[model samples]
Target: MQPIVHPVVGYVCYAVYARWADGTPPASSPAAVAVVAATLPDLLDQPLYHAGITPVGRTIGHSLLFAVPLVALVWLVARRRGQSRLAVAFAIGYGSHIAADVPWHVLAGDYHELGFLLWPVTPMPAYSGVKTLGTVGGLEVTTLWLEAVIFVGGVALWWADGRPGLDLLGRRFDL
Candidate 1:
């Protein structure tokens, strides 16, 4: 999935999960945090691909090996802070991003790409050259259309939310 789509779905999942778990209408602050978490995998992996630090576009960053522990740490802190709902919301965002990518991975014929899901236990397919978004492996038109649909769906959902403003990068404002 594309960067924008990844975070959009993450925000929606965070909102729904928050409502389910906490019986709240998606607390603005936590939902804001979830959006960044949703994009963390690509955020961490891509620079490494460009810098020649890793061969694969997906690395430990995309693996449960990395996310689980980080989430566990966040979970612990959240429990202590009495904000378990927020922590779980972040997990929903992170996990949903990975789930959204699965279809594209399959369409690209990179079924073996699950090696990245295993991280150190299995070697990631490290290809040379910086990876771009939309289609994985090659120009798979189906995957491209799937991405388009997902992104458009996200836009529609955002509009439905009355365009709840996100002040994610500055002032730390959630609403």
Candidate 2:
């Protein structure tokens, strides 16, 4: 998945989850946390891989081994801090990211692409050639179209949900 898609998907998931669980959209803080969590894996793995520090783009950060424990720790800390919702949002975002990367490959019997999910226990495949941006001029027309649809839907949902996190930016910038 592209980095742009991840956070949009995360926000949509959080909105859906909140509407189901709390009968409303997520609040600013949890929404923000979820968006950040969605990108956490790439943030951690991409730099290292591009710099030749790791063999693949989805090593430790994409591993369930790392995510499960980290989320558990986040849950524990958030519970203590009286912010369990934040932890849940984080889990949803992080889990969505991992889920987005794996299921299609698994269904297609491309288990080799999923080696990163186990990390050290299952060595990641070596870095393949760089992936293109999936833009209109790029080769991945289907991916570009899918991402565009998802992004448009996500923005629509966010707007309908009152743009929950917009206030955070306004407050931060004194707008």
Candidate 3:
């Protein structure tokens, strides 16, 4: 998927994470901090992809092994803060990150292999081939639409969660 779409998806997952936290701590809370941290690994791709210095699959950020350890570390930190919720929030975000990417991976294989979805648990790397999201037409249409659906669905679910104010992106400040 495009880097532009990736962040949007991350924000969608952020909304999910925030909803799971029920606004008691806010998205800026320790819980949200872990969620944001989980998204950090993807930020690396922005520079690498734009610079054209790195192949898509060459980055370790795409590795589940790399991410799980980082997630655990953040979870541990949140635990120390007496906030297990934060750790769980991070896990949700991280899982969302992977879940959001699956469609794209299914459509098009990364520059190299598919990616380390199974990672340390299983070394079997899958191949998406070049037919799925590889073509410009497919990616533009499918990814954008998928992002829209996830974004809307996440917001709706958050609303359904019965939280009072819409704290998304600090929008509460507008009121």
Candidate 4:
């Protein structure tokens, strides 16, 4: 899961939250900040890759520990800025990233060496295997399949969200 995937997952998670939870903000709520905050940890990893402190896609950005605290920090900052609503949105989106990515990786058994998520305490290994849906001749067809699934899910989310009274918070937002 890269940064791009986080928002979609986060939105879907938010949708589910909105459907089940009374306090969930709708699409019109100030969710952009929270959504971005949820993805901020990964964005921070971009600089680390340039400095060689960590590999481009192998760092805390993909870890639960990092994502939770970062989102909390965002929430705190947003509170200070009088944008707590946005902070919550970011938290949902960011948390959604973890919820979606972690389990799948766990199930696939594809974690990498440097990708020790639990770190000093747990040092849990991540799944590093590529999940291919199928193979066409010599080429793997998993990528296309994954993309299609994501696209369909995204479309469904958009539709579900567009329904009346579907937005989590009633107010508008900016990310």
TM-scores of all predicted structures: 0.79, 0.86, 0.58, 0.64
* Span of 10 residues, lowest total lDDT, candidate 1: 126-135
**lDDT sort, best first:** 2, 1, 4, 3
Which residue pairs collide in model 3, if any? 31-86, 107-132, 107-133, 108-133
Q: How many Å off is the CA of 174 in candidate 3?
A: 11
Sorting all predicted structures by TM-score, with the top scorer first, yields: 2, 1, 4, 3
Write down the TM-score for model 4. 0.64
The lDDT for every candidate, in the order shown, is: 0.73, 0.84, 0.54, 0.59
For 72-144, candidate 4 gives per-residue lDDT tens digits of 8878998999976567677787766666556445444555443535443445443354565556888776543
Between candidates 3 and 4, the TM-score winner: 4
Off by over 4 Å in 1: 19-25, 126-141, 165-175
Top candidate on TM-score is 2
Ranking 2 against 4 by TM-score, winner? 2
lDDT of each residue in 10-98, candidate 1, tens digit only: 87787677667767556666776677788988999889988998887788778889988988898899889998767887788788877
Using alpha carbons, what is the TM-score of model 2? 0.86
Q: Which segments of model 4 are wrong by more than 4 Å?
A: 23-25, 79-84, 111-116, 119-129, 133-144, 163-175
Q: In candidate 3, what are the lDDT values of residues 28-83, reduced to their tens digit? A: 45334444654665675447645876544325565677777877897899899898
